[model samples]
Target: MNLPKRNSEDGRYYLMTPDAREKLQPLFDRCIRDAIDGKITRPDSLYPPVVVSSEGAPFGVHYLAMDWAEAQRAETFNVEQAVAFSENLRRLSRWGEIDHYLLGVLERELQKKYFVVTGREDDHRWNREYSLKPGIRAEDVPEPLLRFACYVAVSYKVYGLDFQYLDTNYLLGLVEKVRPNMVKKLKENGTGRLPLNLQKRKKEHFTASANDAFAVIRISAKDCTEECYSEVLNYLCELLSQEDFPRSYAVEFKGPEKKYLSITGLPKKGINQLCACAVQYPSLQSLLERYARLAMRQYERYTNLDDEQCALPGSFAVFALGMLGQPWRQLVWDYLGLCDDEHSRLQEKFLREYVKQFGFTADTVPIFVRGVLSMQSMKYSKDYAAWMANAESLGALLDAKARLSEIVPSGFSSDDDDEDDEPTDETEAGPEEVLQYAWETVCYVIWGKASAKRGLKVVETAPEELKERYRQIFE
Candidate 1:
């Protein structure tokens, strides 16, 4: 199938149905009509916010106001925070017990200073009815505040923080005390009148963003003991270790040693940047579902073409993994059993298909290397290309190749090889060369050179022979 056209304005490639707007137009119209007619007491939270276009027909749809805040936050904590967090943890020797005190301190820091963690109050989608109204309306409630409230409530309930701060009745009572005229004015307006700023709007498609709330742990000026510090650090790590998705956020600690500790959900910033440039990522749950729909469609198309092979090309799956990144990468890998040793059937099948597709012989190592090198000549920016060509990455590829050789025989040559075939020098080098070339390309395409360096570092420390081989490659 042909690739989608690049959006001239943003240079993004998008796939949309031919009549997507026409199909959605009536639905948008009905939502506004019902809300105005009071047929529906509130707008449906399920639908994206709808505003009438000044030009008519094509009404503009802004994101779910809440998503704006999330995108902003996701782009904030970043990799530097995670690095700092990790470095600080390395300094502690004597760890203490993680009790209520540490959890309470972190909870208070997160909840009490909500404005700092989340954005300003004005940052939320402002609906007079939802923000000022006396009763609960799911659609009317600003998403950030609701989410914050949920976080605070959950922290108090689960972690046993002072629940008084989040008590619904106490909150309402404060509102009554402070803004007595608010509800009266809302009542006078009858059907909720939107603010002037929200009258007319424009809409854009959703891109997944990393809107995560991070916890920053800091030591007070008091002469903090090492035991107390270790206790706090351990507790934070424990909290960070819970689950992958919703619970996955950055954790930063500022200790007396002047070092910082951080743990974030995604990989480093450089890797994410490279992946972002190469492929569309699905950071948001909604976007993931949309991408899954597209993948399923592709799967069906390939299934019709051939049933003997795996559902998709393993190379294509590798490309998808790079695009997905982080938590999504692990999630996709788990779904495909890419990391499962017990399910080696798929991996072995992929290897056979790979050998056949490329027609690789034991003597074709140089050809494979050249193929990968030629691909690097594409019109990526000079900086991007430089990242892929760096020495550290070459070493990493060498290490990856060496390690993979242990699992798949180093003598693997072609799909037709028999058990009786002798392991010649050429055969021994073939599989390693294939892995080196493929992984080098994958790393270059997905994560650029920095991640490749990190990958080599893993092989350097984790295995003795690979480390020596890695040193030799770079030597």
Candidate 2:
């Protein structure tokens, strides 16, 4: 559909309705007054471009990106150069002696081109391309002059100003005074208007459903010292007391301390669990994800960066997969109260469907299965030799299973422990070990000690051949 074009004479978005014309007349007069005072001699000075489009009318303004020629001319030292320089200075974060030199250049140019009289009044109306004028051809106007006009047009479009007649000298002075202070004012007030043509797309991915909300909780040692198991457990207890969740969640660690930090709650319980989770998992992956999303949003808001350089992490897909495979899986089981038989059947079904969807080789299946098992077994700390051998063995087993059409048995289930089962060792595992085990399992359903007094759960269904291969490497 062809959208109505904005009029270039006034900064509004529609063709000149009678009411709009009435509003614009005074602004045009003012612009002419300013132009005369600033000694702008061209007849075009009395007919400055409009900044908006009226119904059935053409757009009032347009923009070109800052070019090299414009940038160079903005640096000149003369009256006109000074005006252009001052305008640029107003936009810069930091301007110094060089900026002052250019401002002087613009002032001189304005005096030469314009006729400055204290109270002379001039008025006219013309229709042409918003940026062009009869006597003031594009070739005759320096790049700095064009750039300055463009900036004025842009400001008018954003702020709804009448530019047909402006006090150019007064504006020049205002630019000079505010140039150094613009940054401070922006930080303090944040009142600048955005360009009128800018359109923001509504966020489409987020759902208002409570289940869609996720929280990341972070836990840390009260002091920066190494965390103890007791302290971590105490913190977790305290957090649980503060937050109620409809479902379980996952946590992760960040930084060298490995002190428990952040927790991410599933959708239903996010609001209730977030703060407490933060207390337990200080370096929570959910917190990281939130920050990452924010950074990505900021990057998208500004079109200055390329896809590769955007703040979104490269490992996001892998991290998401881990979340789905492990903690999310556990949450489903716990929430649905799946029995051992049901859980095993579901796992087999899932594997078969996944293999079919991906057209994966049988050899690839064992390797993938082993990786999943290792993730579930909390064996990430195993040495390189052990990891490699386990992988190779798993690959071979997957091949055998594929060829035989054998369904692998369920490996480890977290709910299998008997109430009477107890650990033989009395000494508590180090805080690092406890936290690491907890964190990994939360990421990938790895089996580990449920508590200091509980023994570890070994994954049962990953296959004997793969287990033997891992043992040989470790031994």
Candidate 3:
């Protein structure tokens, strides 16, 4: 089987076979569409830079895959940090207890050869990745070694590179699915009234972030001795012995006689850059849950517990894993399983954030959502090609925007508004600007350029609510 080989000239990697792209692009296309429609539990779990897009995409929908060139550099472990952590342990004579798997990883590092280790306890996605360093030719590696890499690379591809993307075409469709409850949420937030649910989510986000940041083990600097270091190492080993830990965790040693030791794990963000993986992706959540629990037991040992007393719960279910936005994901799956539905209901919280950003009046919000959705989901490929290529399509779009402006109100007054402060002609004119923003966003989302210029008219803008353009899919 042909695999990706490094180009001797430019010093970059390329997938060898053309047929592979042909075979796998369609599969990713299906998965991406399903994910956006709320079918997939962990939309963020799909490996290989899976993205959302529309129109020019290969599959007849808004989902596509794009090659992630930056992934290799980002995925490379921090060698300096890893080495210092190891050397400190060895100096303290705690290296013998370093487990076999980590030892292998360390050995490969010392030899100056490349080794990519998959994080343990994965979920719906095959997130295992590889790095083909500069100066390493394809011929140097065995065919069997890269076959799986080739398969995964192909499975989520669109065309040559663009393995995954941010498909804004369907965002309109997604926005159209919002419930009335969500509309009320938008108005509530506009009035500076925080919902109970958001208050809870805010607390959860804070706690999860604080805990992950505080994942450091501390011992007094005065107690600095080989025995103290070994004691800490033994605690870590015992913590790791339990299944409760992120599969990608590593222990980083601090300076000589330092008061603390940090167990650095994979950045909770994982492959989906915007959201943290510990709260969204199942496998990572399971591992972090394990890590947190294991570390807790170790902490208990430092105070009152003995070795046997510090054992973890044998069968802890990682429903929420103590991270923000995870329990709702579990509920989504429970909903799907019990109802046997193809897609879970649109998340009210998600829509709440949506309208919170746009601030559409309850009356006009649905209309605005429908207009954008129609523009995105509309299948006029020949027309879209013309639009991207020239000015007529954009002109028509702007005209449509003008027409939509007349009908759609920009915003609504809260109950606190005085009778004298009620909307007037100037207030009615607000939809013109709002709809102008909407169409500009539509142009940007569809075109992907910083600005869409046609003749002298130019539309340049950004997206909110979906700006990270990256979102987590609920299970």
Candidate 4:
């Protein structure tokens, strides 16, 4: 945490009815339209919410992270708009006259790619010399952040109430507009990565882009006063910081003055008695994870969790509005009560829903099964193997799949078919052969079709062999 509050690493938000959204949309549009119509649009257009706050709500209710006005302006920003904004700032700064180098620096700053540097683990994000409230253990937030974050946030509470927020959604539209150009420049810049220099006091393994930007500003704006160049650089740094993309954003709830949700800590998972702030709010925290995970998979090149753990996180990325999280997954969180070991209970509630939502696809079912097994449970792990060993028909019989009936000698049914209570032998294959082929097809997909085909003949005939072999995948 810097001495003067830096806006980028910190964030803000609002929660209002659909009605409030309508009022805010037009005011934002009004600002842009006015700008195009020759009135200057400043970043502070939405400042002092009374100027632009939605009617019938608390004044100054607008989320203040990027400032509501800045956020609104970004929505319709084009690459051309980004250029104009930079040029406009330059003209106002009189920087070209002061230093031609700064003209280039300012231009280059516009085209920047930022990365997050999550420092130490085990630091509390928020505490009042706060003892760890008994909850699930989580990665720690840095102590400096916890103590200093109040100056960072809290005062801007919408209606004096803390509003939940998104990580990148609060991002400036201008940043998104310049993204393509930023990538090109990043390549031209040839690795912004510097050799490891240990930051001693903070214990942070890495430094933020804000720090990097300030250094550049000091050198580039040597002619300007400390106040002038520093202020400009700080503002620019805040914008660049927004581009940083939070490493691991989370949600925390505590009813207090600066103590409840430790605004000071790194915005990772929940800390202290929060029970690992990651899971409590499915709608919110998971969305942040999905966003961060997506950034890693598509934009960045680092990862903390293993490939197997990436199952859920990797599902949907690079899909804008059209993407959705796996609904069955959200259900799994709800089903996990105090402990995670209730595999049978969860399978009934969780996996059963999955089968319903997704009919037996050879690949997804196997992959999904593995993701479920990733849940940390000795019982789930041990019991899953035993369950599969005893299971007949790859557990298809346990699904919403058509049931076996004496009336229809064709014992199997399309699990995909909802209306058909029992399967008819539509294809030439017999019921036993159909189930066998289904199981084999599933096995083939998991081990990859190119391999694992040779064992099919022996396994198909021997139930015990098939069960043990299937159980091995879990092991």
Best by lDDT: 1
lDDT of 1 by residue, 1-475 (tens): 2322322222211112355545444444443343233232211111121222222222212221112223323213233332222112111100011122222322343223332223456652221112333453334333333333333332232222243334433223223333435323322321133322222111121111121121211222222343333333233333323332122122222223332112122222221222222233233333333333323211111111112222321223333342333344333333332211211122223222232343333322222232222222212122332332334544544544555433232212222123454422222345446556545553444334533654565345435544554445433
RMSD of 2: 25.5
Clashes of 4: 7
lDDT pick, better of 2 and 4: 2
| lDDT digits (tens) for residues 359-397 of candidate 4 | 444322443433233233212222232233334435542
Off by over 4 Å in 3: 1-13, 16-47, 50-78, 81-104, 107-348, 352-475
Model 2, position 305, has a per-residue lDDT of: 18
- Residue runs of model 1 more than 4 Å from their true location after superposition: 1-216, 221-226, 241-255, 259-399, 402-475
Model 2: weakest 10-residue lDDT segment is 296-305
**Candidate 4 residue pairs that clash:** 122-140, 123-141, 125-265, 145-264, 146-264, 270-277, 413-423
- The worst-scoring run of ten residues by lDDT in candidate 4 lies at 151-160
C-alpha TM-scores of all predictions: 0.23, 0.21, 0.16, 0.22
Better of 2 and 3 by TM-score: 2
- Where's the lowest-lDDT run of ten residues in candidate 1? 89-98
Query: What are the Cα lDDT values of the candidates?
Result: 0.29, 0.28, 0.28, 0.27
Largest TM-score belongs to which candidate?
A: 1
Question: What TM-score, to 2 decimals, does candidate 2 have?
Answer: 0.21
* Candidate 1 lDDT: 0.29
Candidate 2, residue 162: the lDDT equals 40
| Per-residue lDDT of model 3, residues 41-126, tens digit only | 21111111112223212221111212211111213554333333322222111122222223233224311254333356463122
